[model samples]
Target: MKTKVNEISIKYQGNFKISQAPKISSSVNAAELLYNTWNKDQIGLQETFKVVLLNNANKVKGIFEVSTGGITGTLVDLRILFAVILKSLSCSVILAHYVK
Candidate 1:
């Protein structure tokens, strides 16, 4: 006889309303939005790699920071980045690099 293995469970939790989704219409708008998000944390002293996940309609879904490194640069793991995007059900992404 063989024992059964437990299955993993996954869930996405958020209270965001679709009607309130913020849209990115221009590069300047994207940059400004990302700047505001990054500024909330102590991320200005180093280089950081972030992904702004978007929906099929190009509305904001979420922002995820992939990595942080020294003053000059940072590295990002594509696997982790894709995992987050997939988990969030995001249809698009904007790559942002921050340097201080």
Candidate 2:
């Protein structure tokens, strides 16, 4: 008899076309992109960590929030971080954190 097992799947979805995604050539470009995507209301209230997922061409795949915490700090799990990068099939990544 075969035992029941859980099946796992990973997916990445983007609302916009890849060609329309902005390309990142410099740290400034990435900061601008991340800044634009950040939630303005939460910028000062808490600490949050995010990852900017990029394609081989350095175009954005998406931004994934790794964790959120109190005003002072947040935690980032390497396992979860890698899982998101692997699942999204990102070629490279930029890490960002916000703190007031």
Candidate 3:
């Protein structure tokens, strides 16, 4: 038998959370910050590309956006991908799986 479960796209209700992480145990390096954020924020096919920012102390400075399929073509600017990372004193980039 081939039964399938139906799915819906209703938005989930939740309040925004704000916290200060001016500095993490780890240095404010892009790679480190990126991995930490991913390990905490995402769930199930969240996105393919991820972006994160960090302060001089390597703490998450701001959000960029993480997704599974944000890329459109092979000619995309690699620099733009790292723009957030470059902008921050230290930042991180993480990759996630996409379910399309």
> Using Cα atoms with residue i matched to residue i, what is each candidate's TM-score against the true structure?
0.78, 0.88, 0.37
For residues 1-100, write the lDDT of model 2, one tens digit per residue: 9899986555557678999999999999998998998899989999999999999999988888999999888999999999889878899999999987
Of 1 and 3, which scores higher on TM-score?
Answer: 1
Candidate 1 residues lying further than 4 Å off, grouped into runs, are 1-14, 40-43
- lDDT for 94 in candidate 1 is 97
Lowest lDDT 10-residue stretch of candidate 1: 6-15
lDDT of candidate 3? 0.46
Could you list the CA RMSD of all candidates, in the order they appear?
Answer: 3.0, 1.7, 13.3
**Candidates sorted on TM-score, descending:** 2, 1, 3
For all candidates in order, the CA lDDT equals: 0.83, 0.90, 0.46
Error of 3 at 2 (Å): 67
TM-score of 2: 0.88
Candidate 2 wrongly placed segments (more than 4 Å): 1-4, 7-13
Pick the TM-score winner: 2
lDDT of 1: 0.83
Which candidate leads in lDDT? 2
Clashing pairs in 1: none
Where's the lowest-lDDT run of ten residues in candidate 3?
Answer: 9-18
